[model samples]
Target: MIMNPIPTQSSEIRVTPIPRMTQGGRWRVEAMRSYTSDLLLWFTRGQGRITVSGRTRGFGAHNAVFIPAGTMHGFEITSQVFGTAAFFPRSLNLAFPQEPLHLRIRDAAPQGDLTLILENLQRELDGDRPKKERAAENYAGLFSVWLDRAKLQYPQNERKSEKADQLVARYSTMIEEQFRSGRTVSEYAQALGITPTHLSRICNKSCGRSASALLADRILYEARRLLRETKLPVQQVAAQLGFTSAAYFSRAFQNHTGKTPSDFRRGA
Candidate 1:
């Protein structure tokens, strides 16, 4: 599950065409992995199933899938597929769906508009036109608008409480800023003016996972990324992740990922 960093044509965004298949038709066997950037995949002609953060769903033509940064995901294409993939940093500040999304573009106008945006985005990346970066950003903004419309159209059941949602979002943002500091869940809860138990309950209700689990997931993802993408040793990676000892870090990583840090690095 070692994913190489995606190359970008622009510093802010990347648009790449997805091939129908690899030369040997063996792209399906790649292990599940994740990215440090947000991903939006548009399938114009395809049949496939995608797994995101342990949930699997089927998709077909005219579907757009979103995988937020650091979420583990993979795909299997059953038939010939053609698509465009957009990768952008989370700092772009687009209010995309918080969770993974599989949006179907059924209506003709929206689908055609989406296709045109993708085409122009590709052209902006490929051609040496003036102010191409700004052009790409504008197209990316339009694409985000399209996705927001799709999310609005998608039906929902009972929604989580607004208060709970706000708490979870704030907590998540704090984690991103402070995960490297070895802060405890209780400390984070105290900073947010809530008890640790209440924070856990809110996280569970909002995302079906505990607050501690979310914190540990972020730490482990960073560990894996460091192990795979850098030459840092296991001990160094452990220390960088705020572990007290290399041995403790190894045990924690094994418990969460079923692989020792050294083994995982070697495999990668």
Candidate 2:
């Protein structure tokens, strides 16, 4: 029998304070298609296959990976799977533990550590303390340690940042770098040597959203990241983002996230 789906909220999706992915023998995960908030994904046990954002990752006795923000990724587990996943952002600018290291273990190795992480996650899941707000902190500690070991197991291979095979690549790159400047679309068009009318037409044809919508999204992404990761006063965040005052920042944040800056920072 099919169970009715649950209701969802507009402000990015977040699951329970802590979610566990565990299953016994012979279970498979179907492809999950949905938009998740900043961070989410934890696998702790068993074995399975995950196809996310076009990359296929295997979750085994000790397989784990993080799906970056706005990355359209998910999994199709071909076997039993278990683990813990967290949806987080850049709030923790980890000092040493997050040095973009590769895991030392091969994909075929036994997943002993994966099991331990799962157990610790279970502990947190059953805890009564306020876990939702502290979730990023916990993941920082875990990721640092795991990434260290994983670094030894897997080394990263950074690809050169080249323009994509599309007309919008150059424009998209510029928008990402200057979205915080709060310039109008015409301003961006001038920098790209394109007219405002052509810019709007191309952007709309390539991206579903309008030029204004995409610019706002880029700005909001950074805003949310800064708000969550740092203890910088809200006023400072506003100034850094070119807002004249905290009040203005609050208004923009509310318009996008539907929560006041202070309220969002308070972990509500």
Candidate 3:
């Protein structure tokens, strides 16, 4: 079931339950959408698979997935799944994971604590108490702390290659800032003081996608978001995304999404 939207004066934090199923009891074909908010998902029951940045992984009960803002992700729950998802606005300023994390809470104590933290966060979101926003932020901070500890106790295998991870993280950050400038992968490589081939290799090892593909993915994600969430004309959207002309943007969009801009906007 879809959880009710949180009513709040500020959009810094939101807590909601994952629906047992999406529309028609099936996952949307375009489920790989990126969000502007960081997402923390705690699965209390059931099993499923999630894809982040083109790398797919399986998840089960007591697993917590942390997806940083602007990362492309999608999930398919094969059975009855129960979970709470907390979305933190980009401006929230918490020291959570900057990279994607798929953590399994194997111990009982941490699992219970996580459940309680989610409960408190939900209560703060659902209540009208004094300083509700502050209380909610506090809960979010606690959640971040818990995540840090959990990572220390259960380090991800990706951390084994620290240098490669750092390079990928830096590349991702640069893409976020310069994706609107129409920079090419070679240009990004130059900025990062690395060759285009080296950059692609690191990105492939980290996320199973090439550097050019990642750049294109970020650009396409922004284009789709603008098309779906705004009333901007196609030409204007193209210009805002640094395309030289509307026709060029249309071609690129069609190549990436298999739909023309007009059709995508209308369907959305």
Error of 1 at 167 (Å): 1.2
lDDT of 2: 0.51
lDDT of 1 at 34: 57
**Residue-by-residue lDDT tens digits, candidate 2, 1-268:** 1111211112322333211221211111232232223443444456655544322345554444655443433354433554445544444554333211212245543356544554565556456768543653564567557655666656555454233213355565566456557678888878877787776676565444455655665566556556655678888888877777789889988997778978776762
* lDDT for each residue of candidate 1 in 133-178, tens digit (9 for 90 to 100): 8898888889889888878876433444388777876787677677
Across residues 1-84, which tens digit of lDDT does each residue of candidate 3 receive? 222132212356887777632432232312445567888889989987776755657889999999988776668765488888
Comparing 1 and 2 on TM-score, the stronger one: 1
Q: Which portions of model 3 show Cα errors greater than 4 Å?
A: 1-11, 18-38, 45-58, 67-82, 89-101, 129-131, 157-159
How many residue-pair clashes does candidate 2 contain? 33
TM-score of each model, in listed order:
0.66, 0.41, 0.75
Q: Which candidate number has the best TM-score?
A: 3
